[model samples]
Target chain A: MAAPASFLFKGKFLPLVLLLPQLIITGVFFFWPAFQAVYQSFLREDAFGLSSQFVGFENFTDVLSDPTWLQSFGRTIFFSTAVAGLALSVALFLAVQADKQIRASTTFKTMLIWPYAVAPAVAAVLWLFMFHPNIGLFGRMLNAAGIPWDYKLNGDQAMLLVIIASAWKQVSYNFIFFLAGLQAIPRSVLEAAAIDGAKPMRRFWTVVFPLLSPTAFFLLVVNLTYAFFDTFGVIHSITQGGPGKATETLIYRVYTDGVMNLNLGTSAAQSVILMIMVIALTMVQFRFIERKVHY
Target chain B: MLEKRSLWPYLWLGIGVLIFAFPIYITVIGSTHDISTIGRGDVPLLPGGHGVENYSAAWAGGAGRFTTTPAAVMLVNSLLMAVLIAAGKIAISLTSAYAVVFFRFPFRMLAFWLIFITLMLPVEVRIIPTFQVMVNLDMTNSMAGLVVPLIASATATLLFRQFFLTIPPEYVEAAKIDGAGPMRFFKDVVLPLSVTNIAALFVILFIYGWNQYLWPLLIVNDRSLETIVVGLTKMIGTGDAQNEWNVIMATAVMALLPPVAVVVLMQRWFIKGLVETEK
Candidate 1:
């Protein structure tokens, strides 16, 4: 894969020159900081940056023993699962509906896809507006209906709100992929199932669902990654991991610990852990998931 | 074609559309109302007569009392950040991809993998250390500080590599036979062919740049350098007290419009680019 059998440029210096800008930027911004994170994880540093001491694996041990850190890890897993599950199912449902030939299908597609363009922060703000207990439309209606929906005070409600908002932003992306996957299926296969007297529901379960598994699985990983790292803005703007840290994910904890609290060692350890998780997840995506995906 | 037609599809599509559109519709309507009306705890579902007043207030004077940076400055900052990040990513990625794909050089694969590894290190994970580096470099509160570090990822380069790999070797051969240098062939031949991919990437990257919250929030303490997305979030305050819902909603609308318009206008390219790039 590195060297394809193609006519190539002969000058060695030109290629180096061409790659210089990216290499320089990556070296300074990517490699340097990543190295710093790894190095700092093992060293305990004061907030004022006046003193430091080498403490091997102490920060990691501290993070592992910390209840809040462990809770955040568990919460991040739960959050990612909920986000990926909700976003995938909703998107797949809509994609299946949109796959049918109907009037204004294009219009529905257009409406559904625009939210992908909305920033996560903005998405949070929009949802917050509708869900604000006092002045929000749904919040008022929910309270009127006596369901007692106040995300601000209720932990579960706060989690649900952030989940819904994050999942809402992701649904559009999942929908596009599912639609593409659905369209890629050969019509003949569905027709064969239809002729054999398979009902639409049964056909979907056995034939369509199995065929769409690759896309579904692909989206599951993507959505999980999004929920893990990309939903920071949603969590930040909506709950700020508030109501007593109910919505705090690993990424948000990293931010709060490092930037807000100035616990450099713990945050650096968390950063290293987060980096490993992402690398592991990305490897799964590239190695296992890509191999299984048919197309 | 043999399937029976039912109202089920329409019902599902209608529900889906409604669920997605309701927030945006309500946001628009809310933006058109006065703060007093919105603050009364029961927002009208219809557009109110205060659209111009609310939007102009948000545009010129900013929203909440705490955030005095107007929407105009924030919008400009967001636009500049988005455009520069998009353009910068594309430019560097294109050249780097060209080098990796077209030339056989030492450590070529090593360079490619080095860049590829950065994908795993999102700015969020290494936020503290990266911030430390920025401070050491004295890059905080500048556009370069905001844009450069974020563009170090290899997604765009990988996308360009994927696109470049599909171009027939004959193009290179033809250009070579005609005495065209690598740069010339890249400029005249390869660049033209990659236009659609670039446009599609522009839409995605523009949104990515515009939506950046955490990095900007950390790096730029100067209110003047705030992007609209971050500025809008700051405008919300901790609670409803002294918070202008009308102006906030209007700012949300303003924040969302440009990217949404780009996606809607370039729907085809955006979709194509998204599907292809993810591969």
Candidate 2:
């Protein structure tokens, strides 16, 4: 969307001019911080904010080589992908199903949003109880059903539990977006598909699903970013990346490193690498998904 | 040929709602239980005999914790800081968005992209440098340190500007014709007319501000300076000493009230905001 030449410089300067103070604040606070992180990633450090060897890429290598670091990075990627992929699929499925309902729409809508209204910490703690296995509703139900499940004993089980919990919280958010997307599709198009003898599965696959691709793609990137970084609270409450390094993620590593270990330099370097991966992935999404995104 | 109505849809919707709403039910049930009952995992559906006990424990605990340490202070502090930051954000975003969407200016496109770019640069990547700024300002452990950095949310500005763009700027022109200054014009004409958007924006900002734990965790490590989110973490406690589940749930329930209030009170406006942007 190129700016029209008629509107380019004519009477546009005033708005742009007014936005300058905001730009300055953002530049100093946002741009400067990002630049500094990248720059610091290259520097050497020790006790008392001291060092100047300019190690260039050595930090990246050293950070990656550590077994704890490598394992955590892999786990972080898995955690994020699982959360995002599962959440997106379920949300899309629910949205499609809900859109077909002539009755119970308002009830479903209200119930769906109620979970999201709960604060993150509260939701996480609540889940911790449900997944407790000793004294949770799910625990009791599973016990009654004669299926014994414990996330504490098995790291793999813990990972799956966290993923499920994260996805459960996020599915509502994605449903909100997907519901909006579903509503945006013209009702006439669906009616036409029905008249054309498209079966339920066929109509969804050929028409509604394709039409929702833009929204799905948008959510894919957003969900990935969120699951990767923003889920520390859930992790902190549920497992604290515990039962060994099984649940440890990059963001958790950053928190433990920067806050607990007080190794600001190493943490900052990790943050820099994490940022680069995110940016590169986002750029790829822009380059490819932007073109592939169906309107 | 097919009807849009389907029994399958309603069945699925009902189940999905159950899956989503189950956690809250668990929390509310947990809150109404006694410590022994909660620990026993015997928290049942209806309000148990422990409702008064739990609520009183949380309130009494609040006074004890607030005086002896920072948890109570943190809650009050978080409220104060979040409210201030929220107000600043609305003011800053409104003025800035109005400037760009309603006014003519050079590098207008550049300003818009700059806003978008902030959305690009993940704050995880930028935390150290931001903390560095705070440290340099000698604002560490201060309420100002907890806030000032957040006054520039790109997402909020973009949302505000998008809504502002649809505000029929002929009103601004008419106000101008009546010799209204920019400030007066914005205060009297634009803002009053956009109460719905403003309310929606407030809810969004308040939740974001309230739920923020990471930044608060990083900058304000002192227990005395903790927000409710960070304070909640402290309840889990040290090695060998088991955390009190009933009290924790009580705190969690309390922490949750603000966001719930925000959502319920402004739900109509919030849906309107979404509807407007979707259009």
Please compute DockQ, using alpha carbons, for every candidate against the native two-chain complex: 0.79, 0.47
Per-candidate TM equals: 0.97, 0.88
Among incorrect, acceptable, medium and high, the docking class of model 2 is acceptable
| Model 2 Cα lDDT, one tens digit per residue, B187-245 | 79778877777777676677778888678877886766778776776675421123466
Q: Which is the leading candidate under TM-score?
A: 1
- For candidate 1, give the DockQ: 0.79
True-structure lDDT of candidate 1: 0.90
Best by DockQ: 1
Cα lDDT, all candidates: 0.90, 0.72
- List the per-model TM-score of the A chain: 0.96, 0.84
Q: Candidate 1: which docking quality band?
A: medium
Report the error of model 1 at residue A273, Å: 0.5
Give the residue spans of candidate 1 off by over 4 A.
A1-6, A289-295, B63-67
lDDT of 2 by residue, A55-85 (tens): 7888778898988899898888889999999
